[model samples]
Target chain A: MKIRVNGEGVQLKQPIQTVEELLHHLNLEKKSLIIEHNHIILKKDQHRESQVSDGDQFEIVHFVGGG
Target chain B: MLSDNRYHRQMLFEPIGEAGQRSIQESHVLIIGVGALGSSSSEMLVRAGVGKITLMDRDYVEESNLQRQQLFSEEDVKNQTPKVIAAKNRLQAINSHTIIEAKVIDVGVEELDSIAEEVDVIIDATDNFDTRLIINDICQKYRKPWVYGACVASYGVTFTVLPDETPCLQCLMDHIPNDGATCDTVGIISPAVQMVVAHQVTEVIKLLTDNQDALSGKLIAFDLWKNQQMELKVATLKDENCPSCSQAKYPNLEYQAQVKTAVLCGRNTVQIRAGTQKNFHFIQFKEHLKDLNLTNFFSNPYLVSFEIDPFRIVVFKDGRTLIHGTKNPQEAKKLYYRFVG
Candidate 1:
């Protein structure tokens, strides 16, 4: 399955069921992460239950500290 | 009317035409942190005819700040001038017509609550989420707009918060500790500061002039070195039960009111403020400092500064001590208790 992440296309060998699975597949730490799926932000608790599909758009924002 | 042709070029920009320029001239902004982003954005706002600017910063200028903190100079470092004072001096030279209020006080919730009330807008030039979260809550509680900006290494991120109309910082990030990337951990470049400043200043102007349609209602993050960028629409991120916006709880304000310790952003410095007000000056600690065999030290009426190997310590008149060389609060507090206490 293929999906877009931060404006880039990514292909997954195994299908990802939810945002949580996608993050696990990509090896991204869920801490300090704000995920936007289809232009909607999913609360951290909601990520596990939220599902993802092919061609779905995702914007993963990693918060940084500095001025 | 403070009529002047100095802003004639800015008046030509249709979005901020003659009326908008006048509105900009009448708008007041409070900028916390006189570091790189704060210095750059304040300069732009002043140049764009911002009427009044209040700058709040706790630390003084240092040699290392010259690279990216634009307004500071060698003289500022040599004199150990506070960041707000140095920036105020340069900003006044840039536009004498704009009123620049310089504050060299450590910003806490109480300080911010009162100061944030007096300004039309606030700018987040700070390097830590501790203060940013406080500013977010205060702005939300009062319904004042604020533009949040942060940068580290070669990357930067920015977002604007309009109280009732949009989601807030708390609504976006669920964690207290950020991604842990800081200028202290990985050194920063000038472009990262400028890029973030560009977005922040643009939002400040748009908010001040009531250019609502022109506002970028998206969260922008970019990595200049990696050639990566993201502008994500975050309007839908607003949580119905958001503590800051929806319920209007303003949690940070109450939580950080009595808090004293803070890590100076990107400086590897930790600041600890005394619980109660106490008079402190160089003369009071001169003999004690000498007894410690610290011959390498300097004392001024305002602050007593000394160096002990890796750390440079500055103790202010208000019993506020800034220990430069460590970001750990406990470590800094240990050093403070050993010497300044």
Candidate 2:
């Protein structure tokens, strides 16, 4: 499956069904992220249930600790 | 005529013509935190002729702050000037006609409520989410508008929250991300700070001049290093179950006994928050400290700090203290009680 992450194209060799799977595949800390799937923000609890399909766009914003 | 001539160029702009300029001159804005984003936004507001501004910050000016924070000088560092005081002096010099109020105290719910009621708009230039959330709660309760801006490294993000009209910060960010990457750790570029403030101040002007249609309702994010920009449409991001806007439950504001002792990200410093808000008289504290054989002691109207071997303790007027040279919250709390109590 291929999808766009932060405006970059990424190819997943294995099938990624949910937002949680994609985050896990990318080795990202789930707690330290604000994920937008298909232009809609997903609550942390919805990460596992939110489905990710081919050609989907994801924006994962990391909060930085500064003024 | 001379007073009006000062803003002649801004008056020429059709959007902010003489009437809009007058509106700008009649507005009041409160800015929290005088760090990078705060300093830049405050400078722009003063130059733009905002009638009055109240600056609230607890930190002092350090040499490291000179790089991105524009409203400070080497003298501020040498004097250990509080950020609000230094910013007020610089902003006043820039526009003496504009009223600048500096408060060197931590802004919790009680302080925010009174200040929010007095100001037309608020700017979130704070470093932490805790303060931002409190701002959101108070702004929502008062039906005031505020601009939220944050920057770290080469990236920055901003959003404007108009009470009762748009989603508050709590509506957009259900959970606060504790990523622990601060400018003190990852480093910040000057341009990133400029870009964030540019957007924030522009929104502020639009709101003040009654140009509500011109305000960007979406969340704006930019990364100068990566050359990426994003406009996340947060118009429909309001959660019905939000504790702030929906349920009208302000946990952040109501939780007053918050004894927050946490290690500042990447600074090797621990902030020992005041268990309760108290008025700390700096002069009295300084006078009492004269008997103690403490070296390198400094006293200002806003705060007082003393060097105790490897540790340096800075006690603010609000009783909150920042303990440098240690990351342990327990150690910071111990020092706070021993020295401050």
Candidate 3:
């Protein structure tokens, strides 16, 4: 299934079911990540329960250190 | 004293009209860490005619900083002028009317408390999480608004935290853990710093000019090289149990009471503020250095820079020592104690 990540479309190898799984696939599960799935802020607890579908947009951001 | 028509072009803008210009002129902004972001944002604030700008930075100017740090020059690097002093010197030249204050001390909880409450807004121009978290905690305690911004490589991110209204940095701290690249590791471009500064200074203008409603409530991010931009809405990110904003328990403030030692992110420098040496005699210390056979060193009115092979130790009047050539706080502490003790 193809899912939009940060405005770019990416295809999942398997049918990824949840936001937590997507984070795992992206190897960012352990990261302190704030995910916006379908334009909604998904809390950390909701990552496990929130389901992802094909063509859904996600905006993921984490703080970068510098200045 | 602002000359009439000095800010005529800026006053022409609709939002910051004559009244807003006066508001801008009457405002006082405290910017921490006069690095790329600090120098750039402070410049915009100064040019926009902010009444008073107090710049705080511990590090001195280096040749590497001139690429993005707009205020410094070869002369500043030659003299090893502190970042805040160099930035203030340039800022004062741009607009003689604006009051540019410079503090060369390393920022800690005690330093923040002394000035945070008085400023209209605080800009996070620091390069490390420890400093930013401290700024976050202190801003929460004083109930003052602060703009959070960071950039590395070709990417930048920023958000404004309005104490009670928005999710403070502590609330988002866990989610935004320190795992990204740094300027020293991946290197940084001028555009990344400029992008973040644009947002930071804009937030400052909105806060000062009574246009708080126009402030961007989203977490703005940019990847200049990849041409990516994201403004993530973070209303739900506010943790009600946050010790910083919710509980009025500023745990970061307690840090000042402890022994202060921190790695100045990516700078290959460690600052150790072990104890206060109220009456530090530079001439006596220079004589002491000579006795120890430490030959390569320089001393100015502000600090004594001593080089002992790999490490260049800069001793301040108050026993604060910046040990360059090592990033280890423990090593820095060891060297500091060996010398200062």
Interface RMSD of 1: 1.9
In model 3, the Cα lDDT at residue B246 comes to: 92
Candidate 1 chain A lowest-lDDT run of ten: A27-36
lDDT of 1: 0.85
Superposition TM-score, candidate 3 onto the true structure = 0.94
Q: Which docking category, incorrect, acceptable, medium or high, applies to candidate 3?
A: medium
Mind sharing the TM-score for model 2? 0.93
DockQ of each: 0.62, 0.51, 0.69
Better of 1 and 3 by TM-score: 3
Please give the lDDT score at residue B74 for candidate 1.
Answer: 97
A1-67 per-residue lDDT for model 3 (tens digits): 9999888889898889999899889887655667899989987789999999988999988777788
Model 2 chain B is weakest, by summed lDDT over 10 consecutive residues, at: B274-283
Please tell me what DockQ candidate 1 reaches: 0.62
Cα lDDT, model 2, residue B150: 87
Which residue pairs in model 2 clash with each other?
A: none
Chain B TM (all candidates): 0.91, 0.95, 0.94
